[model samples]
Target: MSETFDVIVVGSGAAGMTAALRARDLGLQVLVVEKAHKYGGTSATSGGVAWIPNHGLGGSTDTREETLTYLDAVIKEPVNRERLEAYVDTGREMLGWLGGEGINMISMPWPDYFAELPGSRTDRSLVMPPWDGRQLGDKFPLVREQYPRFKLFNRYSMNLEETFTIAARAPGWKKKVATVIGRYWKDRSTRKMTKRDRLYVSGAALIGPLLARLDHKGVKIRLETKLETLITTGDKITGVTVSHLGRIYDIEARHAVVLCAGGFEWNQELRDRFYPVRTSIWWTSTPQGANTGDALIAAEKIGAATEHTAEGWWAPTMILPNRSASNFEEVHQAVFDVGRPYSVCVNRNGDRFVNEACSYDRFGAAMASDQLATGANTPCWLVFDAVFRQKFTAGGILPSAIMSDRSIPMDWWDHYIFKADSVAELARKIDLDPAKLEDVTRRMTEYAAKGEDPEFGRGSTIYDKTFGDPTCQPNPALGAICKAPFYAVQIHLGDLGTKGGLKADHKARVVDGSGNPIPGLYAAGNATGSPFGLNYPGAGGTIGPAMVFGYIAANDIASRATNRDVASAREPVAT
Candidate 1:
C-alpha cells in the first residue's frame, strides 16, 4: 500500500518548503522528499536574499508599473507576460505571507544589477536576519549548511551587513568582528553541543525557521529519499516512485506533485546538452552530487517543454585546492572579489575583455562571448598587483596584511595562484605572451590615471561602485597595477546554477510545447525556465521567483480542490 498525500513536493530548497508550507496552510496533506541527507538544497548555501519588489518592507518605494518597466529593459528574451505579472503580484503576496508567519525578512539596500535600467531601484532585495539554531533542537543537524568559506574560522556565520562591513572595513568593523567572536565564545553551551554556531545566518537562517514551522504543522519530510520517476495516469501526474534505503516504492499524490528539485548544474550530461559555453560541470558553485536535474529529466520524458535552455547564473570562479584535503578542489564564485579596485581580468592572449566591475552575470556572459569569439577566454586570468593583494581579499586568500602571500600554502602557488615580480613575468608564468600582457597593463594604468575605462566603462554604474574601494581617488573601481609582485589567478566560466529547465506557467504548472498545463503537475525554482528569462535582476533574483511560484502552485492546487468540492456540493442526489 502506498502512502497518500494531497501534495508531494520534491526537493526541500526554499521553493519546495514554501510550497509545502502553503499547501498545509490550505488544509492539504503535504509530503516533502529530499535526495540528500540534508533538507535544504543549494538555498542553504546561498545568500538567502529574495528580490521582492514593492514589498513595502524596509521602506521600499517600488511600484508594479516601474518594476515591470525595469524588467522590460533588462530581460532581452521573450517571456509570458502573464508569468511576469504573476511573479510581481505573487512574489509580494508570498513574501508578505511568510512575514506574517514569522519568517521575518528585512530589506537590504542592494542596488539592482542593472540599476541604470528603467524602473530599477536599490530597495527590492530582502534577506532573513540571524536566528537561533538552538531553537531547532535535534532537527538543526538535518538543515543544510553553508560552505566553509561563508563561515568565520569554519565555525561561526555572519549576516550580510556584518560581512559587508568587515569586507569594506567600514566604521566599527573591528568592534563588530570582536563582538561576534566574543559572543560565540561566551555561549559555552552551544559550543559544547556543536562547533557550528547557534546563531544561524544567511541561507540557514531562512531555512531553519521554515523547517521549524513545517514541523509544527506536522508536515512529513523524508531525507535521503530520491525521486526516481513520476507516476502518471494518462496525461495527469499521479505520484512519484522514490528510493529510500535501497527500496523503491510509489507514493500517491492525491491532488498534485510539485517539482522544486532545483537546476541541473551538477549534472554533466545536462550541462553539456543545454549549456552553450564549453566548460566542466565541476566549475559550478552548487554542491556536488546534488541538483542533478532529476525533476527536469523525469518531466521531459513525459513531454514537458523547456526554455532558456542555454544559460546559467554565470559568475567567474576561482579554482582552489581544499586546504584540509589536497586531493579535492573547491570552486568559489568571485563576483565581488573581481569588482574591487586594482584588478583586471584578461583573456589568454592578454587582452582585457569586459568591464571588471560589472555584475557577475554580465561578467560571465562576457567570458562566454569572448570564448566563442577567440577560444582564449574560458580559463581567463584575473591579474592584480601587490597593492591589490595587500588591500583586498581573493578567493580563500585573505588580504596580504592579514595572511601574507608568503603565508599561503605552497600547494596554492603550485596549483592555483600565480605570482611574479612584473606584469611580463606574471604573463610568462601563466603562459601568456609577455609583450601582450605588458601592453594590457600599460593600457590599464592609463585608464586608472584618467579615472575612466573608455573600452568597457568599468566603474560607470551604481552597481559597479557597490563593491569598490571608496577610499580610492577619483573612480573607486579604477586603480593602477604597477606595484611589484603582480599576481594572476585562473578564473573558470562558472555559475551559481543552471537557469534553464522545464517551462512553467504563471500558475506554476509545468506546461507542454503547446503551452497547455500538464495536469496535476507543477514546478518551481531552477527546475523551471525563469520567467525573467536570462535576466538576473537583483541579489536574490533566483530565489525570489522560485519561492513565489511555489506559493502560487500550492494556491492553484487548492483553488482547483475548492472548486471540485463546490461542484460536488451542487450535484443532485443520485441515490
Candidate 2:
C-alpha cells in the first residue's frame, strides 16, 4: 500500500519547505522528502538575503512598473513576462505571510548588484534576524548548518554587519568581538548536551524558523528519501518512486508533485551536456551529493521542456589545496575579498576584462565571456600588493601570518600563493607578457592615485563601494598594485548553483515542449529554469524567486482542488 498526500514536495530546501508549509496552511496533507540526511539544502549555506522588490520593508519608494522595467533590461533571451510579473507581485505577500507566521525578518540595506540599472534600490533585500538554536530543541540536529568557510574562528557564525564591523574597525568592534566569543562558549556548552550548534545566524536563521513552523504543524518530513522517478498516469504525474534505506516505496500524490530538488550543479554528465564550455562539478558551492539534477532528469522523461541550460548563477572561486588531510581540493567563493583596494583580476594576456569591484555573478560572467572570446579567462589571476595584504584577507590566506611563517617546511607558497618582488617579475612567473603587464600596472597606479578607473569604472557605484574599504583614499575599490612582494592566485569560473532546470510557468507548473503545463506536476527553486533568465539581480536573487514560485504552486494547487470539489458537488446523483 502506498502512502498518500495532497502534495509531495521534493528536496526540502527553501522552495520545498515553502511549498509544504503553504499546502499545510490550506489544509492539505503534504509530505516533504529529502535525499540528504538533513533538511535545509543549499539555502542554509547561502547569505539568506531575499531580493524582494517593492516589499516596503526597507522603507524604499518602489513600484511594480519600475521593477518590471528593470527586469526587461536585465533578462536576456526567452523572457517569460508572466513568470517575471508573478515573482514581483507575489514576493512581498510571501515575505509578509512568512513574517506573520513567526519568522523574524528585517530589511537589509544591500544595493542591487546592478545598481546602475533602472529600478535599482538599496532596500529591496530582506534577511532573517539572528535566531537561537535552542528554540528548536531536539529538532535542531536535523537542520543543516552553515558552511565552515562562512564561519569565524571555525566555531561561530557572523552576519554581514558583524563581519564588516570587525574588518573595518567600526565603532562597536570590541563589543562585537566579545559577543561572538560569548556566543561561541555558550554554543560549546550546548554542544556537549545537544550535539548541535546553539546560535544560528544567516542562512540557518532563515531556514530555522520555517522548520519550526513545519514542526508546529506536525508536517511529516522524510530524510534520506531519494526520488527515483515520477509515476505517470497518461499525461499526468500521479505519484513518485523513492528509495530509503535500500527499500523502494511508492508515494501517491492526490493533487500534485512539486519538484524543488535543486539544479544540476553536482552532476558532471549534465554539466557537460548543458554548459557551453567544459565545466566541472568541483566549481560549484553546493553541498556534496546534493543537486544531482534528479528533478530535471525525471521531468525530462515525461516530455518536460527546459531553458537557460547553458547559464548559471556564476561567481569567481579561488581553488585551494586541501587543508585537511583529504585528497580533494577546496574551492572558496570570492565575494568581498576581490573588491578590496590594491587588487585586480587579469586574463592570460594580462588585461582587465571587467570591473573587479562588480558583483561576483557579473565577474564570473565576464570571465565566461572572455573565455568564449579568447579561450583563456577561466583560470584568471588575482594580483594584489602588500598594502592589500596588510589590510585585508584574500582567498582564506592571512598576509600577516603567511609573511611571518618562514620556518614552515612545506612548499605552500609554490603550490598556492605566488610572490614576486616586481610587477614584471610577477608577470614572468605567471606566464604573462612582462611589457603589457607593466604598462597596465603603471596605468592602474595612476588611476588609483586619482581614485578613478577610466577603463572600467570600478568604484563609481554604490554596489561596488559596499564591499570596499571606506578608509581608502579616493576610490575605495581602486588601488595600485605597486608595492614589493606582490601576490597572485588563480581563480576559476564557479557558481552557487546552476540556474537552469525543468521549464516552469508563473503558477510554478512544469511545462512541456509546446509550452503547456504538465498537469499534476510543478517545479520551483533551481529545479526549474529561473524566471530572471541569466541576470542575478541582488544578493538573494536565487532564493527570492524560488520561494515566491513555491508559494504560487501551492496556492494554484489548492485552487484547483477547490474547483474539482465544486464541480463534483454540482453533478446530479444517478438513480
- Please write out the lDDT profile of model 2 over residues 343-388, one tens digit for every residue: 8888998988989999999988898889999888888888888888
Task: State each model's CA lDDT, in order.
Answer: 0.86, 0.83
Model 2 / residue 207 / CA error / Å: 0.8
Native RMSD of candidate 2 (Å):
4.4
Q: Which candidate achieves the best TM-score against the true structure?
A: 1
Candidate 2 Cα outliers beyond 4 Å, as residue runs? 168-171, 187-191, 194-196, 399-409, 562-575
* Model 2: how far residue 195 lies from native, Å: 7.1
- In the range 411-456, model 1's lDDT, one tens digit per residue, is 7884698888888888888999999988888888888889898999
Question: What TM-score would candidate 2 get against the native?
Answer: 0.95
